[model samples]
Target: MSAADVWPIVKARLELLDDARKPLIETYIAEIEHRMKHYCNIRALPDNLLYVWASMTVDAVRVDLPNADEIADTVGGGANIKVGDTSVSGGSSGSGVTNTSKAVIDQVVLDYRVDLNRYRQMRWGG
Candidate 1:
């Protein structure tokens, strides 16, 4: 699909206006990794994830199965456990974690589910 086919349509709908286009990458899938930096805490990875984030656009796309052999080959098919309880209050927040210590993560999770359902609908021609 073309870039113009996807980019401009969603730009007008989103409210907050922060860019949301995730790059089609090969390094590893990006997850919000929070960490402590110099004096203040930073909620990001200390690597090339940010650079990969910008050179893309806010367009939804899909691809085939991953040839990923990283975790499955390295550790006998175990997945990493992400901490924090998914609570009634959404993700959780206190002092020095993520801005996601609030309701944003919760909403994002809900949005993800909705998107997944839409994908299923599109796949099945429903």
Candidate 2:
């Protein structure tokens, strides 16, 4: 199915202004299509799964949006946040670091019962 076919679901999942998010949504749809293009053995998934994947992609990208402008300045440092006289500071360095967005997306895929291996292309006879 085309991006237009699944746009309503994507929009509802995002819950944002259509004008503000349409470009990003299109980008994600394009990325998904491009990734699947070379995988010859990929199974034909249901439309719901495709919609979920698209929504997940949007969510993954959204997680990074908050830091985009800050990162573009080439200035890196800890974040100092204060709320109601309470202060908190943290940096992007240290151990036990995990990509929370990816983890969450992975969990969502599992919740949806997606078989990720189906997207892989098999090869035989080297």
Highest TM-score model number: 2
| Candidate 2 per-residue C-alpha lDDT over 1-126 given as tens digits, one digit per residue, 9 for 90 to 100 | 666766666666545443565776577665554444333344454454565566545544433332443221222356542222223233333322134533534443444344445555686666
Task: Report lDDT (CA) for all predictions.
Answer: 0.24, 0.46
TM-scores for every predicted model:
0.18, 0.46
Model 2, residue 22: C-alpha shift (Å): 0.9
- Candidate 1 yields a Cα-based lDDT of 0.24
| Model 1, C-alpha of 21: deviation from truth (Å) | 11
lDDT of 1 by residue, 41-110 (tens): 3333234323222222111111111122221222122322122332221111111223342233333333
Looking at model 2, the pairs that clash are none
Give the per-residue Cα lDDT of candidate 1 at 3: 33
